[model samples]
Target chain A: MLAFLLDPAALSGPADGASDMHPTRQRLISVATRLFQQRGYHAIGLAEILALSETPKGSLYHHFPGGKPELAEACVTRIAESSLAAIDRLSGSGLDMIGFLRRLAEVTAAWLQRTDWLDGSLLAVIGQEQGGVNGPLSEAVRIAYQRIEMRLARWLMAEGVAVARARDMAATIIAAQEGALVLARSRHDAAPVTLVTDMLCTMVDRG
Target chain B: MLAFLLDPAALSGPADGASDMHPTRQRLISVATRLFQQRGYHAIGLAEILALSETPKGSLYHHFPGGKPELAEACVTRIAESSLAAIDRLSGSGLDMIGFLRRLAEVTAAWLQRTDWLDGSLLAVIGQEQGGVNGPLSEAVRIAYQRIEMRLARWLMAEGVAVARARDMAATIIAAQEGALVLARSRHDAAPVTLVTDMLCTMVDRG
Candidate 1:
């Protein structure tokens, strides 16, 4: 897995020790993110993360002090940011808005296809895994979903739609996509994902 | 854990069994459904189900020849049937169409609330649980979701809506409610479920 980081210091730098991205941190995040995304947060353990990441037990705490919960927070935040960035990139390509969404759907389909039809959202899997009774993980999920909705809402507003209507529609679209992903994962197929995107684009055109 | 199956003996009654439901069979389904809902499918074991339901070990195989997968299938089927029956009862009450949907939402909300703010859809939980590659559970999930969508579509069409449009809307509403349940479960709150229901009702009214 690539080194996914919020800061470049987590990359490679000299002068300050803080400027250097430790290998262990990168390894931990990459492995934990994948496992949690695949099997769910509650179903994964630190030992498995360590073994997959090829990192030592001693340095796990150096990166995440709060343990799995902290790791989960980091993963959720990272994925949320990455998703927003991907949406921004899709929108920036100057494609028509609906076409942009379709392209987004296709790219998502390709990614899931590569993962052998595994569900990729860690927060989503965790929410189901823990069943929302746990506080921190549940909060992570709420914020992550809200972030996606907010980003989509912003896009809708940019298209000169009504704010309230755009917000509701954005939430609906997000829910549809998430639900479609669940369907895709359950059936181990990407057709539902693409079909939903088509349906959403059709709805947008109808409006 | 109330009896999930309205009639478990139906499975055997087709052959050479009593016409009435068996006590151990009902107990097994009831406990297994609750456990599968509260904990996950794989996380709960046959021993745990037997212990909780107080059904003897021998009776489990007697009731479910295919073991956990068979038991899970039975639970999913029963929950789906019960939910459809409830919706039918509500819609058949001779209320206005919108009034019927509202009541349906209320009943759904009440059930969700009583479950301590947990997402109570056995089908949705099972779908997520069986999100594996090419498993029997995955196939069961697809059938369960399809069953839900078809039933909802039938209801909408019977209310004098266009067939294609009703099916589309049914798919959307089912996806939305399932998504909202994910939110509600993660937040451990009923507000999201109610919000989604209100949104659905609004959309149905406009349509």
Candidate 2:
């Protein structure tokens, strides 16, 4: 289910073996993303990230010279790219629009349950906490969310919805899912997310 | 728009003069609420709150003996009470369900614009950041959100919807609005929120 929101491949390591494959660097990025998603960006410090990643202090500066901000930016970029790819893959599948939305919701709910509600979409956390405070991080989050919205909009358009309508529907879907995830996590239950999924399906089917 | 999510009266001060009228304490609560809403719960420090509130250190400990956590709880409680009161006022105003939601969206959008998207729902910031991390704070946030949801459900029930269906729809409405607010704040525009509002009104009107 997390794959629907963030690609596991991106979290683990680089897709291409061309470079950027240092085990220490990959571990740092992976751990940082998890910590940021779980505990928020500001709450987690560089020492914690370093200690959790088990990477040396020297290696941290070597990989990310700009420190926490630089590392956060990298995590956001990777997650964004992976999420966009996942969207493309899902949209290209043989399922119709309604089917796609149902599948997406199921995966999301399952992911939330699996994580014990400790994590939600990275985009959501970033968008909520860091959106306006940090310039580069905020921009990265915006781009990530916009890319996902555009991907959803394209799917709606393919199903015969008008351009403007498709865009609006896409925004609604993303926003609703994000909000439901927070509710679900807060209550430690998946019912909120499931309810939202059903509503989205109904609305899209009617359209 | 903020009045739709959080009552400005709550943000500023008490509407009545019957009691609970400690100006220093009230000022502390108000400033803490705004800071927590704009930045986040963990991001804002007690010292900063003191500086912003312009209250003495001894006074902070005097009013909120439990320190930052106590102050945060007070803020959450006050905001929740004010928000519920605002909803009551809106629902009692004789507007249909659609009209109520449109007004809510408009007010929320305008608030976002007015604050340059730096501020969103206090419940949202608390629910997203402190939820699942701080036990007391999480519970406070949950109660705040649930109270709002129940108020919304009551409105739907008054419109002749069944109890169970009304409850689910209310949850959906809150979740969607919360999510759209994040998107709007992230993009530094209110278009996303406006789109969600229109869709919500359509759904409620049809039902």
Best by DockQ: 2
Error (Å) of candidate 1 at residue A136 is: 1.8
Cα lDDT tens digits, model 1, A1-207, are 001111222222231232255667766776777776766665577899988888877788878888888888877766666666656655677776688667767766776777676555565566666663656766777777778778877887787777986766666566556666666666566765665666567556654
lDDT of 2 by residue, A80-153 (tens): 76666666777777788788878877877777676667666666676667646758888888887888788778
> Which clashing pairs does model 2 show?
B1-B107, B1-B108
lDDT against true structure, model 1:
0.64
How would you class the docking of model 2? medium
Candidate 2 lDDT at B194 equals: 86
Tell me the tens digit of each residue's lDDT in model 2 across B42-119: 888888988988998999999889998889888888777777777777878998888888888888887888777877
Error of 2 at B30 (Å): 0.6
Question: How good is the docking of model 1, as DockQ?
Answer: 0.34
Best by TM-score: 2
- What is every candidate's alpha-carbon RMSD to the true fold? 6.3, 2.5
Which regions of candidate 1 deviate over 4 angstroms?
A1-21, A45-48, A56-62, A65-67, A91-100, A189-191, A194-207, B1-19, B43-62, B65-67, B87-101, B155-169, B188-207
